[model samples]
Target: MTATCTWRIWGLEASLTVTDPHRLGEARSIVDTIVADVDRACSRSRPDAELYGRSIRRGRPTRISPALCTLVDAALDAARASDGAVDPTVGRALVSLGRNRHLATESGRPEQAAHADGTLHVGPADHTVIRRHGDMLVVPEGITLDLDATAKAVAADLAADVIADEIGCGVMVDLGGDIAARGETPVGGWQVTIDDGPDEPRTQIALQGDCAVATSSTLHPRWRHRGRSMHHIIDPATGLPAEERWRTVTVVAGRCVDANTVSTACIVKGAAGADWVAATGLPARLVAADRSIIGCNGWPAPDRLAA
Candidate 1:
């Protein structure tokens, strides 16, 4: 019997497929268990989630769940590699930009304001401190963290690994457009559609065997703040939206976490990001804001799809 199911988890619609003459029921059970576990581990809105606990607590390193720890550790390493181009402690900035709600929700709430006296640190892979003085939550001189950019990728990787191990079949996990796949599938590779904002042409990417793919673009929802349009991809150096250079960047790497992490960093890196991605030897496609496309290193032009 062949069965497929689609449900929302980790802020995106996750589709699971299973094919087996026997153990169809068992397959469904395993998929459901993975979805539930991923939701509990990565849902940012959940106040009790390990991520939230760490974020809410000012200077304390709360003991995180193993799954959450894995995600965080990956994010921290990415932050270091990018020289702080990607950060995991930008929850406060994301909140301030009115993106404080879960992706599945229809409405968003304004981020609570930090205490007036709060000071934040902004640098590459350094200890950050935040303190509260009376009504103000100070960032303790200079410390900034933004993990929203990389957390989704980490979660996708974790979900894919967990699903493949438990079900012993192919697993495709997508957090928004970022995806990771493992095991074997009926099709030669998974088919992925890339949304390049509005009124622009969409592209497709194929993943075979084991690979992680992540797409970062400025075309997502945004709002005007201080007379400038603000997007979700924050630059840790300036604590502001990244400058518009490429409209979108899609990267394929050995792991979903790396793909997702580098994609976000590439957005902030601008034209220089192309060189950076090429140097890493990962296959990547970049779409400029002008609609021109460029392929880097091992990545081929969109016309050439691997079969």
Candidate 2:
């Protein structure tokens, strides 16, 4: 029997499910710890949070927790994979766009964003001491890190794996719409509902064993600034919202972080987005600003009969 519960977390909703209903409590506890660790390490809004207003400014090495280092590493990997389409160095750009730590509508101090001259860098391989220090992160001066792009997905992936390992059962963790699964597959596998905001067509898909699904959309989490519409997905090149060639993009991958990375990058890739995702060969659904759906790389067609 699959048991699940929902609650608010990280300014979003989180759902946890365990194949063995009795393990729900244990699973939830594990997930709670994972999310707390992430928030404590990566929160940009909390004054006391490790990353709050923390900038290296001038290629200086800064000390951070191992957990945060791992998260930043993932973000950098995403940026590298997407060719800077999904950048972790856009924190200051976001601030310039009026997004504060709370993601509130109020404008923020522009000085808090990553500087125009980007010189961000990471430490050497795991356990290796680099030119400066051991396990020390060298964030360029004025480069503020914002791991928001992959934070929730990281939490989901981490929670699912930890819960399954600790409880010896199948588990699925969904942070907002970023979902991850591990261990045994339930009776019908993992049925995921893809909904990108209101009035948008929705669909369901199934997954088995370990897998992940995530969606990035421009329809929601938007606001008006300087009398112009804006969104959270910033194009590092322009230091502004992704030009909305595609309104939403969802991808399924072996991991939630990868899925989110590709999906978010798809939004920023603009006209070449579909082709870009198609090249990755991951099944994905792209919805244009006009709400027209385009399925690629084996994405299930809505008109096709379910077999």
- What would the TM-scores of all predictions be? 0.77, 0.87
Find the candidate with the highest TM-score and give its number. Answer: 2
- lDDT minimum window of 10 residues, candidate 2: 122-131
What is candidate 1's lDDT per residue for 1-307, written digit by digit as tens?
3355666755556655544425445655655665455446555556555444433344343444555555556766887777778876665555544555332112212332344434222233342343333333333222333455666676677667766777677766666776887777656567777775568767776777778888888877577654557787877666557888988888988787788778888999887898888888888888898888888776756568653
lDDT of each: 0.64, 0.79
Which lDDT tens digits does candidate 2 get at residues 1-307?
A: 8999999876677788889999899899898888889988887667466665344434457777878777877887887899878888787667666677352213333433343434122211111111224457775544556788998899899898888788999988999899999999998888888887567878888887799999998887887766778899988777778899888899999999999999999999899988899999998999898888899888877765133
Clashes of each: 18, 6
lDDT (Cα) of model 1 = 0.64
